[model samples]
Target: MAARVGLNGQAPRCDHIDLLPAVEPGLPECKECLALGQAWTLLLVCLTCGWVACSDDSPGGHAREHYRETDHPVVAALAPETAWRWCYVHGRIV
Candidate 1:
């Protein structure tokens, strides 16, 4: 599958992306959703503060929530397709 491109047809530099911590291979769960007894289809970890949240496809959309709350722009997929990273601020994949 193709990684998502920005609507503007430009991919931002990965170096510009804010990464607080490398993805955790050990913990594959979304902490926030688990606390409420919810399951997640996908997991995204905030690249700024290493916060874990469920993807929009999942029930809570906590990944976007983390972005809204902290403006932490980049998030790496916590599990599947680990090569891709998303920028919530510019709305692109890097």
Candidate 2:
């Protein structure tokens, strides 16, 4: 795999990519999605601190919230069949 680089051009280590189980280990099922009954098409993974949150503009804004609360450094687009991570601190696509 030719590591995908983020904006900063630094390639993130693929070893950090974690495969979440069907039932997420620690994340709470999106309540906003449940209340509005909307299903999320994509999930956001925080590479800076390894936090997983819903995408921006969602009811929870979990991803953004994570950034706000934790100040984690990076986040990447999480997909079932993909392995890639993004670093927020360096503004790179590693």
Candidate 2 C-alpha lDDT tens digits along 1-94: 6776545566555333343223332353444466667766556776644456677656567676677777665565666667655544555445
Best by lDDT: 1
**Range of the 10 consecutive residues with the lowest summed lDDT in candidate 2:** 16-25
Model 1 lDDT, full chain set: 0.76
User: Which run of 10 residues does model 1 get worst, by summed lDDT?
Assistant: 17-26
Q: Per-residue lDDT of 55-94 in model 1, one digit per residue for the tens?
A: 9899999999989988888888886656788887667677
Residue 2 deviation, candidate 1, in Å?
Answer: 28
